[model samples]
Target: MDHYSFFDRDLSWLLFNERILMEAEKETLPVLERVNFLSIFSSNLDEFYRVRIPVLLAVHKLAKRGSSEKEDVLLEAQALIGYQQQKFGKIFTGQLIPLLKQHKVNLLFNEPIPNNIADKVMDYFYSQVMSFLQPIDLADTKKSFFPENNRLYFFISLRTANDLERNVILAIPSNQLPRFYSVSVADEQYILFLDDIIRHNLNKLFKNEVVTGCYSFKITRDAELDLKDEYHGDLSEQIEKQLLKRDMGIATRFLHQPGIPLRTLHFITDKFGLQSSSVVEGGIYHNLKDLMSLPVNNPLLRYTRWAPINSYHVTDEGSLFDHIEKQDYIFHAPYQSYNTILRFFNEAATDASVDEISVTLYRVASDSRIVNALISAANNGKKVRVMVELKARFDEANNIKWAKKMKAAGVDIIYSDKALKVHAKIALVKRQVNGRDKYSGLLATGNFNESTAAFYTDHIMMTANPLLLREMELLFMFLAKGKKSAEGYPVDFKHLLVAQFNLQSRFMELIDQEIANAKQGLPAAITIKLNNLEERKLIGKLYEASQAGVKINMIVRSICCLIPGVKGMSEHINIRRIVDRYLEHGRIFVFENNGDQKVFMGSADWMNRNIYRRIEVCFPVYDEKIKAEVMQLISLQLQDNVQAVNLDTALQNIRIEPKPPLIQAQRGIYEFLKAKSDN
Candidate 1:
């Protein structure tokens, strides 16, 4: 409870994953959706180890300045992950299994196939699965062979012709084949894991050698790309070179099935040269993250679908730009269709009055309609410029491909700055309104990727404001010139809060104003909705605001370091984390300016990278109706009892105090918007 102390970001992230696990543990939800949550949890941990574990290990090997703090954090993260995996096991076996049986979708794990479907499964093994699998003998191979990262493998204990025990590894081709095999036998239906199918047919895999036992295991390698801090060459080329060597990075986690003979374990470790800490004991079947493709088409066993509804702007006739000029509109995504945002680009591409289009692409969908529109606009002879960030971790290749395509289409492709990443989501379309050039653009709290926009909560503002649009034009010019020309780039802005220059200072000033108001006995409050909050200065400022009696509420989806509700230190602050059907991704900052409230939404979180290393934007909600809409949305999220967990002093995601009426914020937003559209 000491003042100025913060939670470790990695550990806080584990608590967030734990919240996702809790969703899988819920008995009320349909078994399929619960399975989806389980898949999400497992996948989240997989990426965590892939991306973060190497960074910690690098402090010793790469940085050569290894600290005990990093070591301690790795240990803590691993221990928590181990504990959660145990819980996951129990949920899958104890809860999920029985529920599956109740629904007649028997998802068999490592257990043997039933007598009725045994023949059918054997037929599938020979016809489909057997052709793809080829086991490699670990003891017989001369050199150490590396397995593909995160792939499911069967570690077999075989008795050779000499009556000696030999261990071999056979990969489960879940990548090429489906993980779950559905077998329909007469009146009942069954789902079997590919692990079990391989396990039952081990004799067929090794015809000459006698198979004794089969167990599942997987390995996770360090997936961090260590691009040189100072790269004078092409960023895309360096990243591509590193990406090819990703599988060869340090082995972070070596997870094997529990109770594998010590001799086999030792042979496996010695072959791979794995450290003691790298080895982790897992359950029967590895890589349950494949549960996402359960392949069941039953609607009754899934959450009732709530389709995204179109708002008034999309349905309104005439140009999309004209509507924005008349009034600033916000697209509350998934609750409202992302099609409107897509329509903006489509209309801009075809509009004869529009002559120039510019935007920043951080992470776009694989099949992006927005990109298609930009291509169309460029082909139509309009000046289209795109500043594409090629450093969007795991998405570098896709962005590069799009960049090449856009460049070939006569569009100006802008690479990122050498030292900084462009993370802002903004698009500008300049059109001649009565021979006077005006701008219609969008400022969003998330990526322009329509695929993620379906579920990731974000605020996209469509406006034709002269001041904001002019600044956006200047920003595109600044980005187009690359890093060296940023001197006279007009970094100082009065309307849009730009990161690396004004965002942090402006936020601190706002917090200071709240503190002053609180000291003057005026109504002072601040509400923040973001994905992460790990910035030290901002967290310290929040501590100051809490001491000054400004009430604060936060809805952080992941990685919250600031502990709340502590006596005398953070008594006036409370934080809520909501994990529901849709991701809580919008970053809304609401400050009570006495009786008048000011709202801002943006891409930047209160994190170090977002505040300093990247270019971000936070725009104000000026329209009264839009402001009220955001206020109500945040209020609904704050009031959510279901799917909302209170981040306790010990960093535990404890259940909120339940009341009679329940409020799930994602559902609330959808219903609120749908009701408005109906009216």
Candidate 2:
């Protein structure tokens, strides 16, 4: 193994979070959009602490006392995130709210509200929100109050008629009520958080007690769901049991008032065995992410909706299968319509010839039309086999619900077997054409979510090649049966690089070939576009290639740990991150194999989990025209200066200094596709 010094993964992830914060800090972005950026930053951090940080903590505790690197990494991550969290608070409270006020939108609290508005709020709370309040007196009760994930609570302190301090805990019923309620007075419209609604009604909630003050806060727990070895019982049932305990996860971070009387804090912490260090003194309000749901009775506060552009390859007159039969068609999602992939399934369902449909669903939308079409296929007497992964992060419940729905629809459902989670996005359809068995399949980089398809850039390869589609069917067969002893067909994968089989080796070989070409004074280059790049071995290989004079250009949207542009180390490597209107999610790899370029796009990223652990597929672009189009898209992204930010050696995100006449890549690509359609 090559001696490598890589940035810690957790710290690198924190840097990604900071980059998101940087977007919030940008004055160029719209004021409301900036607030949305802060909301995104907080939500992303909540998930990071819930899933990733807890795993690291578990690994550290299991290892006992070997390397200090893990602990060090955790400490550094906490410090960096803490700094960024402070910055986020400052930006939101100091900058964004003031800007919103300038736009005539004021988010007010209980700081001497104007008498008329205060009376109106009190009347509103009494008639509309008072009945929803449930208060527990903490002074006399031995029963504890445990808040669920992302739930808001208020600690109310009161002075009784006997001149004694008493406390009551109230749960904010925002789940049942809107987070923001608009109240209009004379000529001004004011927005108030539901927290304030409860705040305004404190005296009503504690009718007998005289309310002194009430503070609003929340706690985010470590959300890593643990599971045991599978037994003879049903797996779905077992998962359901485990999921019920999801709320009981260890508390990771607690956001509370700055000084709520140390005794009161201690009482609450003692009940939960939480330490003060884990407790963050957040502002008066908790769960600021509720800002994302800002009721837009005013359409001017929201972003203008943009329709997803349709791909040039898809036309109203033809079956998607017929088009794929001619040549491999690549669907670039959000940019190119996801309807192409949907039409593929819809057509397969309606076609009398299609005999079987197999798909692997990871994170699907709640109202998934994809699942609806799959059900329609099963109803049409087609063999619909769905390998629904219930282990998708934060989406386990949704996946489980869909799994039961699909199972009830008479579709064959397969859950994951062992330690592996099937993260692949593949759909195989077996059809009979001219009384002969023909196959079609789709391999995508992102999940089959229709709503997200309008905002997330993804690539899906639709093909009718028997050589590839037959293997996909077999692969799903093996996945469904859980037959580990069964070997895959001994056929050469000329186009697709399936993980757990050939993806890693193929990537290494491609990198080595580039290195060799560079040494031989030939044209050698590589371009990689991925959501994350954190695998140490792959980064080392890229560094080796870079040292050998191979130019590498990388567009990694998140969690990039490699240090680029270092003298004598990775001088030839260029790293850029694009945060634009659409999420840059498609994973594409282009290698200059002695100038005979090879381009591939699929679900796999450079993360080790994607390559060596999970089931992923990266398929080569066979059609020259499509390959050219993909190359043009990649080239446009490579040259993007408007939304692109360069990553420095220390991972500090430096804004890309744009040229005079700048190009925003997504808009440019839309124009490019439109021009192609016109031609």
Candidate 3:
């Protein structure tokens, strides 16, 4: 672990965000999709300030302020962020606006409102926006003032009687109103931001005063919640309290309009406790994450939608249980349907012989059919148990809400222990078939939420294997009653790799097997696809395999610390990342053991938290057909050059020189599955 170099984790994440920005800058992509990329980039940067900046600030503050590694990181991040912001502005103002205008879609920014549309804009403003406006005096002596997180406000300069000037903060009505105001004028269409409409009506608000200048600004606050050590008190209660405290946490970044007067900026900064961090000068529009909601409804200007591919494995519309019982079935999401799993739960809920249901809910959709099916199962006199992980960040409130509803519906709700987050995705259905208890189980690399299944490429395994189901039953029991009710919960996992006990060791042993195979002059190769790869010891093991001449291909989507292609350390290691129509979210580890390959997929990423902190599960792919499907999917991804980028040691995305008959992996997989279905 010590001999080699590693990329800084936060910086690596910044590079990933930069790749998203690069997507926005790609001329080949559709303009509207590029705008969506811009929104994703903007939101990503906001989170960087919200979450990562706080940690960096804490490190910088406790050390020598002038010269620290954290300070250098902040400076570097600012530079990179500044560059990206400038690019975003150029793309927005210079390129996208003109292109949309060419298509007769007018998105007017900093342009004079033509005579035809001014009246409608004012009428809409008076009716809809005027009531939402709340202008506050910056010089109020009654109370102290500070900006809230991520909301847009205007720092305005106004002139009153006797030539006296006043500074005010105009809270833009974007919260209660749409960010864009679209209207058609005869043959021309106009779209305006809510900021400018208010800007146009500034004189109306200031009756006796002269409107001077108006500029936009927003604040990004530190959003990382601190959970106390487990032995303190009730974990859920503590989490609720911490969520409230998050609003009052330290402000990390102050983003302001570029042309604001020095006096106004100073007045605003001094009134609030925003003197510590550097202020970033930005455009009149602050939260451009709203760009995701661009109101153009033309299909010609957007990416063509593709219908989700069907599961060829489930050939007929027979019982899902029958299909899985015939052989193990693996479902690839987005490219394949999620309804089969939904049917599994619905059938379990409605089937007359079904007796019990168990599931782990990490993050469910707001209108989750899964939870509804579970509630129905409980109402039908079936034993239903749900392990809701309330510590899922940004999702705690929703999970808590669902948990209360499920608890009220006569379902058994077991909250996750504060010491370990149950991040594994698994569901068990116990049924009495012919008076003998039979088990059907589901395991996946993603959440059970159907919303993300439309865009996140994840793997789900439907298995009727008795051994795996028995182990899963033990896991549920252990989760419900930790350490006390189970005899060998932590020590003895052979088929499934659980995080607290066997995940890291099993992966290490697998890597060692590959290394031994290579040393013995046999075929040794590995392909791993994961969201992140940062655990130092496992990375070190990969490095060892590299030195032993075992070829490794890693498709890491984000925050990869391993420096691949380094001589004498990781020469045999190569890493590429695919950022495309679908998020590469599934975790797969394929090892070539001389000729017979071994495939395993699961929820656990090769990160410290996933390995040592959370309760995760990685299960082996035993069925030959399902194993081949998983391998085929991985092989398609490896052949992909249209969306794949080779991640070099400098962390730059060097485009892979695509082979002939260029393969876009997601499309190829869809076609492959479709052909299989046809056959």
Prediction 2 TM-score vs. true: 0.95
Q: Can you write out model 1's per-residue Cα lDDT over 166-229, one digit (the tens) per residue?
A: 8778889999999889977775679998878888888887888888877777888887777786
Model 3, 164-206: lDDT tens per residue? 9898888897888999999987656689999989998888888
lDDT of 2 by residue, 1-679 (tens): 3565577677777888888888888887777777787888888887886777676666555556774445545556677877887898789878977777777776775455566678777877888788888787776667767777668888888898899987778888888988888777765667888787777667676777888877776777776666676466777777787788887778777778676778878877786666632576777777777778775455555556556666677678766777778888777778666777778878988888889999999998999988999999889899999999887877888888998888899999998764567888889887788988878888888888888888888888888877677677767866877643223645455657877777888899999999999999999999999988888888999999989999999999998878899877799999999887677899999999887899988888888888766778787777788789899999999999888889989877889888877988988888887677667
Give the least accurate 10-residue stretch of model 1, judged by summed lDDT: 62-71
Model 2 residue runs over 4 Å out of place are 56-71, 140-142, 297-304, 483-492
Q: What is the C-alpha lDDT of each candidate?
A: 0.86, 0.80, 0.86
| lDDT score, candidate 1, position 444 | 96
Model 3 worst lDDT run, 10 consecutive residues: 482-491
- What is candidate 3's TM-score against the reference? 0.96
For each of the candidates, the C-alpha root-mean-square deviation to the true structure, in angstroms, is 2.2, 2.3, 2.1
